[model samples]
Target: MADQDFDVVVVGSGAGALLGAIRAQEQGLKTLLVEKADLFGGTSALSGGGIWIPANYDQARAGVRDDLRTAFGYMLRCVRGMASEDRVLAYVETANTMAEYLRSIGVPYRCMPKYADYYPHIEGSMPGGRTMDPVDFNAARLGVDALETMRACPPGSKLFGRISINAFQAHSMLSREFKSRFQLIGMMLGYFLDYPWRRKTQRDRRLTGGQALIAGLLTAARKAGVQMWRNAPLRELVQDASGRVTGVVVEKDGRQLQIRARKGVLLGAGGFERNQAMREQYLTQPSRAEWTATPVGGNTGDAHRAGQAVGAQLHLMDWSWGAPTMDVPKEPAFRAIFVERSLPGCMVVNSRGERFLNESGPYPEFQQAMLADHARGNGSVPAWIVFDAGFRAQNPMGPLMPGSAVPDSKLRKSWLGKVYWKGETLDELAAQIGVDAAGLKDSARRMTEYARTGKDLDFDRGGNVFDRYYGDPRLKNPNLGPIEKGPFYAMQLWPGEIGTKGGLLTDRDARVLDTHGQVIPGLYCVGNNSASVMGPAYAGAGSTLGPAMTFAFRAVSDMLGRPLPLQHADWLEQPERAAQRPAERMAQAA
Candidate 1:
C-alpha cells in the first residue's frame, strides 16, 4: 500500500536518471522521475558534457576502427584491479549500444576525432575518436517554463558566462584558429539577434556541453510521458519481509510519501562530495566540501545513504573524479582548472616551488599526484599555477579570459587579489604566493629552457599525444613554454572533484549488490550513486557520463525483465580464463 504508484521510480534528475525514466516510460512502465533540488539537472548540466564510448557508430562512420578487445585491454590497464571484469566488459560491449539507442530517440552526438584517450601510452589506447559530445540543443524547444527551471551550466563551461559552445568549438577557440574566431563572432551575433527569446530571457537559447546533453534527454523524456517531480528527495528504501525492496519513501513538500514501484527503484542521485563529514572520513585529507565543483547542496549523498541503509555494499570510497580547482569571488563552488594547466607557458608548483608530476596529464592523474606529493610532506595541498604575462595574453585561466580578450584593467576589482596574484619578477611572484623564491626562479628558468628545446626535461610534460590535446598547437611543443615575461601570475589550486566515485556497488546489470555480493532485488543503481565501472582511473573524456548512462540503460533493461545480452558470455563463465592477461583477452577478441 502506498500514496502513489508507478512502474518505475527514478531518483535524481541527472542525465543517467532521465535516460532510465525515459526508457522505462517509453516501454510502458509509467516512470516517475524525482530530484532533491528544485532544479532538474545535477552536476551533469554544469559539466563539459563529454562522453567516452569506445567503438561508437559516430567513430565508425568517421572511418575510425575500434573493437572490444582493444577497448577492454585499455580498461584492464586503467582500472588496475579496482573494477570487476564483468562490469568493465559490460561497459565496452554496451556503451555504443547505449549511444545508438539515444540517437534513435533523437539525441544525436558528434564524435570528437581529436580528443584522444586519456592514457595514450597504455596498451590498446586509441589516438582519438573514443570521446564524443552532444549536438548543441536549442533549449527553446522545451519552452520557457522548463528552460527556466532547468539547471544552467556554470560560467566555466560558457563563453563569458553567457554564450554556449560545444566541445569542438571550445577546442577550436582555445587553439585560436582563424576559422574558429570567425565562428565565435557569428555565434555572438546569433545569440544577440535571437529576437523575442532574448527579450523574454537572458538564458541563452542555445545549450552546449552538459546542458545540451541534458536538454536532449529531457526533451525525449517529456515526449515519452515520464512524470517529473522537483524537490522530492528520497528518504528511505522500503524493503519487505523477504529483504526485497518494494518502494521508496520520499520527502515532498513537508511530508513523506511512499511511492511503490512495480518494477524497481533506480538510484542515480550522484555522490557524497558535498558531505564534508564523508569527505574527511573517506577521501584523502586536506579535502573540503567547498572545493568540489558539483552543484552546491545538489549531491549530499541522499542516494548513497538510502542504498547503504538497505544492505548495499560500497566500493572506491577513497576516490573521486578529481580535478585541480580554484576559488572565485561570489561563486558557490570552486572552478575546475581544465585545459588551463595544460596550456603552454604555465606550470603548477607546490609551496616549496617545485614540480612533482607532469602538469599536462589527465586531470585525475594531476590531482592524484598533487595529493601524493602532499602526503610526502611536500606541502603541495594548496599548490599554485604560476604563469607569465605572455601566457596570460594568449590563454584563459579559470574565470579570467585571455588578456588580449579581457585585460586585467577591465577585471572586477574583487577578483584581483583573491583570484589572480601578480608580481613583476619570479622572486616577487613567489613571495606573493608564499612560495620558495629561489626554487620558483630555478623552476622558471628550467621551464624556459625546456620551452626553447621543445622538451620538458624534468617531467616530460607534452610527451604524450593526450597531453597535447588541449595545448597550444601553434607552439613546437604545445605544452612546453617559458615563464619569462614580467608581471607573472599565480592562482591557488585545490584538489577539487566533479563528484565522489564511491557509492553502492552494483552488478553487471546495474542491480545493487549487497555486502555478500548477492543482488538486492528491485534495487538498481547508476551514475555517481554506484561505484564507477571504470574504477579509479578515467578512461577518457565523458568517462563519467558515458558509463553512467550505459549502466542506466542496462538497469532499465533488467527492470523490464529483458536483460541486455552480455558480450563473451562463454569467456566470462570460466573464472580462470577471465583472469588471463590482456594480451590473451585481445587474442580471444581477435
Candidate 2:
C-alpha cells in the first residue's frame, strides 16, 4: 500500500546478495535482502562452502605462501580472453581485503591448508590452495524464528540429518589414525542422538560447510540490523527518465511493491540455471530446470530478466560451474557424483561400453568430455558408471552410501535402461545397463591389466594430485583399481551445475556495464548474476565463492563511499589474555 524506500535494495538471498545487504546495513544504509523463495539462503546453502581467495591472510597465517604475481599468472593462464584484465586484477587484489573485512564484521572461517588447486599444472598455481569456508556457527545464536525460515541442505548432500561436515572430515571420517577413529565415533554418536530430535523438530539446524557459511553471515546480518524478506520476486526495474535503475518492483505477499533504492539496486539474485527457457535459448544442447543442482523454484532468472528489461548487457550467459550428477527417486534433488567415480574399482563408460575421458579427472573437465561425447553422437549422453561389487562395498555412489544395502525397490531394468543396474557378471551388467557387452568386457579386461601395472596407457586415470585427492591412498594406483570383482554395477550420470556463472556485464567495481562499455549508474551485479571475473576456469575449491564475495564487497564499497571494516581473529591474538578479567589483568601486570 505504501511505497517502501531504502538506501539499497538487493535481490536474492544467496551469499552475494546477503553480503551486499550486510555491508549496506553495517555502513548505516537502510538495506533490504529479498529472496524469491521462502528460504533465506539460495544455492549458496547447498554449496561445499569453499571460497578461492588467493593471497589471503589465512594462507599467510597458516604458513602457506600466495602472492599477487602467482595469482595473476594463474588467472592469466586460465581466464584467457573470457574476462577483462581490470576485473581479474581487482579480484586478486581485493580477495584478501574482503576476507579481512568480513572477519571484522563477525564472519568466521578456517583456511583449507591442504586443499590443492583444481588445475595445479597451470602457471602460477599453488598446490596448497587459498580457499576458505565459514567456521561452524550455532543456530541457537540466530534464534528459532530465523532458523526455521532458512533453507535446509538436501538429504543426499548431508551425512547425518543436518550435521554438516567439512571436506577434510568427509575424506578422513574412516581414517586409520586413532584420533580420527575417535572423532568418527563421536560424530556417529552425535548423529544418532540428534537424528531423533531432528525428526521431532522438523528442522535440520546443525549447519556446516556452505550452510555454515551462510549461517555465519546470517548471524552477522542479524547483528547489523539488516532486514530480510522471503518470497519476494522482482518483477521489473524501476528506472528513471535518464535510464538509471532507481529501484525495483517486487511481488511480495501477492502485492506489487515499488521500493526505491536511493543509492542503487544490486542484482546478486542468480544466473539462469533454473530457467529452462533461458537455458534452452542460451545452450545449444538440451537441458531442463529439473537437471540443475540449484533449488527447485529458486533462481529462475527473474532478477536477470529485470536487468535485461532495463538493457543490462549479459555476458557468457550460458556458462556454469558444472559437475556430473545423477537423480534418484529417493532423493528430492540430483546428487553430485563426487569421490565415488574416482575410486579404484570404478569406471565411467559411455553407451558403447567405451571409456571416454579420465574417470578420475576434475569434475568440470569430466563434464566437458561428457558434453563433447554427447554433442558428437550421444555416446556419453546417458553414460554409466560401471563398477564392481568390491567397489560397491568400499565406496558410495551418488545416492548410494557405503555399507548401506542398495535399495531393491526399483533396481532391475532392461539393457536400454537409464538410471542404474546390478548383475552377477560383466556381460549381465552390460546387458542390464545397456552397453556393448563385448566392449564392456574387453574394457574390463584391459582395466585389470592397467590396475596391476599402475599405468593407464589410454586416459591416465590417476595422474595428477588433484585427481588423486578423490582416490584411495591405500591402493598403489588408487584411481585405476580393477573392475574384476563381481557382481558389478552401473549408474548413469547427467551433466549438472553447482550454479551458473554468467549474467550482467560488470566492471571492476561491479557496476553493470552496457554493450558500449559505459557504466550504468545506480546499478550493480555480483554472484552468478554478473559475468564471473575468473571466466570459465574453476581454479580451486572455492573459486566461484571467493570472487563472488570479492566483487560483491567492491560493489558495496562503491555504494557506501568507504572500504569495508577490517576485522581479524582478535581473540586468537592472546586468548588467555582475553580470558583474564580486566581488573585481574592490571593486578597481574603490576
Candidate 3:
C-alpha cells in the first residue's frame, strides 16, 4: 500500500470527529477526517444536539447561574460511584471551557428551556444549565456542494414534509392554546417554502438541532482548512515497531491505503449498534438490528474492534444510550420514541401483562427496567407498549401519525407475529398481544382507578416534571390517564439504544488505555468509541454529546500541549449567584 501522510488522522465524522480535526488543524497539524458512509455526519446529525456543559457562559449571560461544585455533586450522585471521580471532575472542570472554545471557533450555543435533569432530586442535578443546545445554523452558509453533503434528519423526525423541530417546540405543540398552534404553523410555513425549492437545488437552507450541530462544525472545519473524505472506512490501525499507533489503513475506492499520522490517530467513530453479532455478544438483552435507531451499517464498531484487537482496555461493555424505538419501514433509522411513552393513557408491560415501569421515565431508565425484567427469568424480550383508542385519537403514537388509522398490513400476522397489534376488547387484545387475559384485565382496572384518584399506586407515573414534560398539559393528571377505551393498541419493544456507550477505555487526557492500564502512546478516542465519563447514568440532556465533545477538546488540548481554559467567569464562584437555582432556569428559558 502507498503511504498517505498527515500529522493527525481522525476516524469518524460525528461531533467528536469534526471537532478534533478542526482543533488539530488549528494547531497547524495536517489533520483529516475519514468517514465510512457516503454522508459526512453520523448519529450526531440525527440527535437532539444538546451538549450538557456544566457551567456554560450561555447560562451566565442569561442570568441563569450554575457552578462547578454543584454540577460535580449532581454527577457524583447520579453515577452512584460507577464512574471515575477524577474523570468526572475533569469533565465538570473542563465542560464550560469547551463551550467557550467552540464559540471561539464559530459554533454558538443557547441554553435549552425547562430541560430538567433526568433525576432532578439528585444532589448536583439542576432543572437547567446542565445542558446547552447549538444555535440554529443556516445551511446556506456551507455553500451548495457542502450543503448537499450534509446528512438530513431521519425519517420519523420531520413533520408535514421537509420540516424539523426542537424539543421545546415538540413539547409546546402538545398544548391547546392558539399560541402554540400558531407557532407550529409559522414554523411549518418556513419548511413549506423550502419543500419545493429543495426539489430543484442542492441547498436545503434551513438546519436545526443535530443538522445544525454537524453543519456548523463542518463549516468551522472547512474554514480552518481541515480535509475530510467520505466512503473511506478505516480498515485497521497502523502502528510502529515500538507499538505506538502511527496511522491507519483505510479501504477507499476498493483499495487499502496506509495513511501515516506523525502525532496520533483520534478514534471518534461511533458504536456497534447495528452489528447483530456484537449486539448478542456484548449487550445483555439486545434488540434486533432491524428495530434499532442507529443508521444502517453506520456504527458497526470498526474503530472499537481495531482498538480491541490492539489490546485497548474495554470497560462498560454492557451499557448504551438506550431508547425504546419501533420499526417504520419508510423511516431509514428507528421510529422515534421521544413523546409517545409520556403521553397520557400509555403503559408498558412484560409478557405476563403486568406493568413493569414508569413509562414516562427517561429511555435509559426504561431500558434498565426492561433488562431487569428479562433477568427475572421470565421471557420479557418483547415487552408490549400499549395504549387505548382515545389515546391514539388524542396523540401520535410512534410513527403512526396522529388521526391516522393503523395500517392494515401491520395488523396481519407473520412469522414475527404482528409488530403492531390492535383489538376491540381487553381479552381479544390480550390474545392478540400474547398475554394473559386476566392479568391484562387486572392491570387495566387498576390504572383506571388510579387515573380518577390522580395517583399511580404501582409506579407513580406522573410524579415528576420530566414525566410531565411530554404530557398533554390540559389533562388533570397529565401522564396518568386510563387505557379504558375500546380499540386498544400495542407495539412490541425490545432492548434498543440511541447508540452503544461501551468502547475503548481512555484516561483523563482521552488517551486510549491498554488492557494492562498503560497508555497507547499515539492513540486517543472520543465520542462513543471511548468509555463514557458518565458510566451507567445519563445525568442530563446531551450527557453523551457533552462528554464526547469535551474529551475531544481535551484530547486536542493534550495533543497540542495547551492549558485548558478556566471553566467560568470569576464572579460565578459566589454561592448565591452560582447556577440558575431551582425553578429559575425554567423562567429564564421562558
Top-lDDT structure, candidate number: 1
Q: Residues 545-589, candidate 2: write the lDDT tens digits.
A: 787778888888989776333233231234344333223433544
> Is candidate 1 or 2 superior in TM-score?
1
lDDT of 3 by residue, 101-195 (tens): 88898778888656778886677677766678777777777866886787778756766545767666776876555577787788767766676
TM-scores for every candidate against the unseen true structure: 0.96, 0.91, 0.91
Candidate 1 residue pairs in backbone clash:
50-542
* Model 1: per-residue Cα lDDT at residue 153: 70
Q: Which residue pairs of candidate 3 clash?
A: 65-579, 65-580, 66-579, 74-124
Q: By descending lDDT, how would the candidates be arranged? A: 1, 3, 2
lDDT of 3: 0.79
Provide the lDDT at 319 for model 2: 74
| Better candidate by TM-score, 1 or 3 | 1
Instruction: Give the alpha-carbon lDDT of every model.
Output: 0.88, 0.77, 0.79
